[model samples]
Target: MLLFSRFAPNVLLSAAVALSVILAAVMLGLAMDQRWLGLKLEAQPRLAIPASFEGLWIDAIEHDSPAAEQPGAGIPASVASLVSIGGPDQRSIQLTPQDLMEEPDALETYAGMRAFFARQDEIAGILRSIGGVELGVAFLGETQTYSVSPKHQRPVTSLPPSFWMQIGVGLAGFWLGAWIWSLRRGEWATRFLLLAGAGLMISAFPAAVYSTRELALPGRLFSVLSTFNHIGALTFGVGMIGLFLVYPRRLVSPNWLAFPAVILGAWQVVDILQLADGPGLGFHLAVVLAMLAIVVLVAIQFKVTRGHPRDRAALAWLGLAVVVGAGAFVATVIAPNVLGIGAFVSQGEAFLFFLLVYVGVALGVARYRLFQLDEWAFRILFYVVGVLLLLVLDAILIVTIVDERAPAFALSLLIVALAWLPLRDMLARLVLRRAELSRGNLFRQVMDVALTPPGRDQQARWRALLENAFRPLSVTAAADVQDPALIDDGLALAVPGAGGLPGYRLDYADGGRKLFSLRDAELAVELTTMLANALESREAYEKGVAEERERIARDIHDNIGVQLMGALHSRGLARKDMMIRETLTDLRDIINNASNPDLSFDEMLADLRSQISEHLFAAGVKMKWEVESAGPAILPLAAAHTVRSVVREAVQNALKHGQPKSIRVTVRLDEDAIALTVADDGSGFDPSSVQTGNGLANMQARVTSLGGRFNVASGVEGTRIEARFPVDIVRITQ
Candidate 1:
């Protein structure tokens, strides 16, 4: 669980250290286990002394080693009928078919398995004293005897399964302990878990090496390893008891933990030194007491953590894991030895089974955030509640609806789906105070940030946008982050710089109500990406704006500036008037962005009319203006500018060409468009004879280009120019 959990970058702690330790432990075990692999053991006859012991069986020897040359060494199982070993200056032991079990079993009572290993020990001692793997055997009912030396060390190509199994358990146990320790360096429970794992490793690694020995090892070396194994096992038991005493609630002061340690340490010492009458029983009894102590302490924790649901939940799972794993080990392995009974499970194999405790602890911490495992576990927790709620509802409906399992269950399922699907999120949000990350909302906010003026203002908006999105308790500049990061086990979330804003780390999401989850880290990435896109767009827009401004500057200098210089040099008023008119005409070429423009139609019209009236009056023409409205008084800027150009050009035409006496300009505003008419009482030109100037053509082109119509009616009585233009270019209005 720790291994997989750490793989998720956003989930929780980084356990490189733990994983390193596990690897180191595995390598160490492999090296130590490889030390004793001097024979091809498992594939050979392997001393297959069946529990029924049916006279010692042997396989046909293939090589002429010392043991292979013995008389009975080549005999098959059927030919052996081996009964006893009473050779001169060698082992004197009796063997029969109905044998005592030397294996660990799932069903064996504790008392049935105690003497089994001690007897094996006695046999092992005799073999160690035999100088070599030479055993004398006397066949039953035959009075013939033979001796074979079996210990021929060879090039072993493989290590046994039990060796690897023990190594695997050791690695996992140490990894779990280290993983928890990394989550919080100083928690008491975490320390206990590590202690437990250390003990298991100490015992398991040695056992992996010694238990898989092909034959007997040096008696002294064997004794030392055995003593160390006991020390590790007892230490493990004591560690578990200490863990329960402190976790979920403290049963005793942490300082007082030394007392149990000292007591168990002394018991272990006594067992090793053989000060007690039965060393095996003393060791077993110490383990049993520790297991019992764990049970009692777990009960106390369950009771003490009652008011806190989270604590209770954590304790409940951890408690169950501890109880089941430790209880199984005690009942199957230690209890039987203590009771002097036959153990169904072999001691070495039972050591492997004991590893389940660490596995369970890892799972408990991973699933429920026990021992500071962090908040990602809560997502799973909510789903767990949903499952439990569904079961409960199903049961209630089944009982109440009576004999209608199908429909009742279906209804229950539907109800739970509806209720919990939303309620689970609601509860999580309530508990965690998480924000909903809406893409639409995010888009708008990013656009607003993009609209901010680039540089410091835009950068500020970028920062504000992140703050608004996450609502963290605090935000600080984090320059080192080059990408999004959920760091300090999700205590802070960091996002890289975007849109001229510096990178930042946000701490304690939702005012410390919750840790940032993997989902939050993902959101940070998305937000950063969006901000980057927006910033690119803004940069593009600003570039276009800069080019447009430069072009305008050139236009002013080349057109208006040159004309003004000429006007300054000119001495005549008529020449200056003509120059001003030429300047206004040149101004028409200035670009106007017409897409999606909006303004008050009435205001634009009134301002244009005022300018036209003043110009016409100054030109000595009587001016009468009228405007009609159809409401929804807004129009595009392009339309307004077009109207202004037409009005100005028409007045110049009537005054300069036709020599009008009076001019009438009328504008009509409608919901979708505006219409303009300019009439002058003057000498109208003949249609076929008189040629119009650039003024009328420009007006006609401008009006028609915007999907509008233009017409000129000229007669001897007067001339009238009329044009209609769409007010909205892209459906925007006030």
Candidate 2:
């Protein structure tokens, strides 16, 4: 337990910690999701005039006579109202529901309202030809109710793609942060990155609610969203700046971080006090200045780490991240707002740009080990440029020949195959003139080190191999690397030692044009791993010689030494010859066991019984051997050897020291443990009376070393020595 505790905490804890912080940020920004801003306006039902039916009428009536002689005077006055006198008796009038319903107060009930317009079409047609002159007729019904009020425009309630994009980007930032944190093994720089991601996600709430510009958001809510957005912007800027300052190189003191905080806070103060012509513009300017500072910091890092390819590469990657992420946001969001120009793309599209920054940063730190900077950078440039070209071409086609999507997509793909591929390849060749080593070839080179002769300078050879594969400016041994480390971003990869071998530091100085990227770092790691294996092999070879010598010395001292000592003090040649033969047999057993260590309990006990029973029989002592194991218990080579030796020594003691007439050896398994006992019908001596000797101490040490108990319980009736050892069933099986 103590040994396990010595290692660093689990990597999963990074994700757990990051998730807690992000979720807290989410809850803090929850009101934004509830549409506290004026960005969300709801539509209410209202009456509207129907312009389509405005001037058109069913029929016109010409009634030149006075009201007493008007046409259809036979009908009720309310129905007759559909005909009316106009201009003079010679003129035609278009009297419809509009005229009748105009005097709604004249009718008392809902039925009268319905009846007024019911026969307007027929009444108007009947009255149309009454006058000599014909007039156009029309019926204007009551105003119609529409779902939306024409007086107020409302944002669509259904989720828009832009809103979803904001949501996805926000959530993606948080999840990506957690994932990066988990993978980073708790690097402090990654922690800042995680914070940046959380802030981005929190700010997404406001972005989502305000995606549609036409929405009429509430004033107070808008102010709150604006504040939240500024906070998010500040957080992201701080994170990015901190990452630049500390990562790849810690050029500035941590105290420099306070500058952005104070600046942003002051800007926020101005915004809150409404001191600026544009309320949020000051905060945005502060954020922009902070971002510009980050760029300068990265450039400074690049300059400082000029000769260090890995660090330079990391700074270079950060530069790209900033340009792609911040540039996209500026072009899409900030510039339009500042210039009062329409945005070409929605702010949601900026999420992709943000993702690019994260991906670039991740590559700079984690991926640098995997790829060669030159080749990887060339490929990325080619692919991105080609894709952009294709998009431009497709867009051209959209505005020209192809107005629909399907045909445009097909044509774009066709153009990509014919033009993009050729262009990308040409660009790649122009940029990356040198050919890279294939993965398989590199692996083979690493493998060849193992086959090198022992006398050769394997360490130097491995170093040379890495130098060639990675093209590092310098390679030196670092305090035996135990794991892969990113030194100055991807400028150097510190590979830990393998199998107790010394580790090496890889340094790359490729000038300013090229820096070690993720792909390069990955290949370096492979080479380092290969080097580690070679070192371990050399270490194992040297250690094996020492271990073998120790084993021989211990074996001689324990078994042969004691047997020879006993023979020297014995009385007869027969006993001496017997001891010598036993010694020879023990020597053979040691050699055999050395080659095959996994000796099971049942097999070792059977051999122990065989060897001891013969010795007891020769000594004119009856031998009763009883061995039982509940399951196939496999003991380690050393443990099995100790068990056999302890049992053998006990039987010998009973016959040689106690002069026992009969001996009984018993072995049994109990649950996850095993027990061994030797009993004899001999006169027993008090253990306290006998002084502790090398043989007795050795036996006790062996049992105790295996985490087992060893004891001798003796009485006059019989003497018994017992040893018990624990076994892990699952561990043995595995």
Candidate 3:
């Protein structure tokens, strides 16, 4: 029941439409058969008065009859001779004057005349052969003339070509009508296809009937059918013209469509009225004009919409349909009349070519998206050119060397293998570069970015890559985002930011020359998802690193720092107490606060001095601090740790190992780097005898890691250590 409700109305309407098409086809067939019917009737036998038949005989005269042998002596030649008639059944007959009075049946009269001729020939032959008796031919003046009439039976096999033509026309109409009915309402192209289909179907009926009119349909039916035939012809031409005008694109006003109907109707009326003396040139002129108009309109459509992928695809298919369908018509129907040669194919077969147009249109109506029609069109173009080249070369080969079709085709194949096949791919690539290649490489690039990670400069890099991909006039973040997926805002694509994704607005794509298609839209969505995934991955990675660093910092401060504090409290000896203090300060600075960068210059210096003084004062060594005009400057966590570690190591080595009398420390800031110098004047020692220890090695490594310079000069005179760190590392504020 549900199915019935959904489909019943359409089924009923389609049935009605099909019935109408069949009726029109039948009518058109009958109409076009009028002339053939007239010729057939005139050829059929009819009775005539014997006076009108005058000197003519009505039967086949026997040559061996005594009357014929004696010529004028036996019987009148006019009475003895007969007339020959040809029709469905061929016959030679004679009629007596009494036949006219009886008004005999044509077939029966012809049969009687035939038997009389045979009997006379038999009697005369017997008499002549016997050589004893003779027979005289008597002259009975025949007042009735008999003509042979055979039963007119038209079997399907023997039906004329026009009958098949009507069938094809009717079938084509149904195909297109069903196609139109299937389409969405209000489609202009649907209307065009229906009009053309209707015209073709309507015109075919009378034509079919006319071709087979020998079956004896009434004469008045022919007159009525003929009138409709002209009307159908005009309608077909108008429909064809209208189709060309509206399809693939609409290039004209709807009002202009009425002109074809009006003009064609006027011409048909003129021809029907027989107002002019010459043949119906006006109807022919109108058709020719419609064809010329079609050519102009097609050119305009191609001109206006060229280079657009969708339009180009539609045009390509439409052109193919025209070439296949129209080419058949011209070759079969038009060329025969124009060149005075037999048709290449029968008109019935020619009608089948018109289905190519319907197929093309069906593809168009389906939107042809699934086919990737742009690439197919390019392939077709290359194929056509290649085939044409092969044909030309083959023709030359046939003329110049190979005179046979087999050899020419073989050589053409070889040429195609060597040249056209390879060249065609290259040509297609050149022509379809933008259509086939642009989006392809872009997706690969997007995938690469997704698989790999773009770092801190990801935004800029992504922008450049996108610019190269789409060749957009501009790409910017949308000020207002409506949808986070992929927004097509007519002029651009707005890909919104989500999670860690950076949003982008691509404006005026392809340098503002072309609009994006559904394929492009889909690609945009994929690319956006890739970009978002890439960004999210980077953000997650950074978040994980930060969390891990914080965890490590807490572990160091809680566990290790407690151990150093305990040691400081337990020890009372100067060196042990100072060692514990320095260790705790180093641990806090290096591990607990290594990732922190908020400390000011004053606080950093104060802590450094306190640690040094505590250690030096315990060792009975003086510590001098010369801190210079260091303003409100600060250091990055890594740089601060490096500086503190280097300075502390230098002072501890001098106080504990070098036994220095005093240590002088000077800190100064330059525009680009901070310079820290520590010098010790103590017991002289030979530097060459001493090998590097872990403390000295560690200080050098720390300074180098911070992208700074570390210098140590040690001799008998004492050691001086200098370290300079770049301002960038510490992020010093003036």
Q: Largest lDDT belongs to which candidate?
A: 1
How would the candidate models be sorted by TM-score, starting from the highest? Answer: 1, 2, 3
Q: Write the per-residue lDDT of candidate 1 for residues 1-734, one digit (tens) a residue.
A: 44543444222322433343455455444334322212222212344464332445443333544444665434333334444444346556665332222222211332322343444455455544444433433334453555454433322334457666777677667656765665565677777888888788777776765666544344445556666777888888878888888887788886898877899999987776666666455577788888888888888888888766556767777788778876887788778766657455655677667677876675555444467665554554454446556766777787667468788778878998888888877766664545577889888988888787768777777788888887888889888889998875566799898756789999866665445667778888888898889889889988977965765675566556766887778698976886686677546545432232465767667766666776676668899898888564556656766777788778877887788889999888776777899999899876556455456776887789789999999888789999998866534344
Give the number of the best model, judged by TM-score: 1
The lDDT per prediction is 0.66, 0.59, 0.55
Predicted candidate 3 versus true structure: per-residue lDDT over 652-672, tens digit per residue: 678656788889999886666
Per-model TM against the reference: 0.49, 0.44, 0.43
Comparison by TM-score, 2 against 3, better one = 2
Judge candidate 1 at residue 410 and give its lDDT.
Answer: 84
lDDT of 3: 0.55
Residue-wise C-alpha lDDT for candidate 2, range 1-734, written one tens digit per residue: 24323443333433344454455445334423321111111122122542333322222121321222324422122111122323224443344333422112123332442344343333333333332222232224442211111112222333446666666667656655544554453464666677788778766656665443322234344446556766776777777777676777776676775666676667767755646655225555666677678778777888888776555566667678777787687667665545644445656676667777766654554334312223444344344446555766787799789999889978998999998898777655554434567878776766666545544355565666766766667778988566777676455667665443457777763433344555556666676677567657766987887986776677778898888887888799988888888888788778877887677666677777778977987899998878775566677676677777788778877876788889888887776777889999999878887777745677888788778999998899879999998764412442
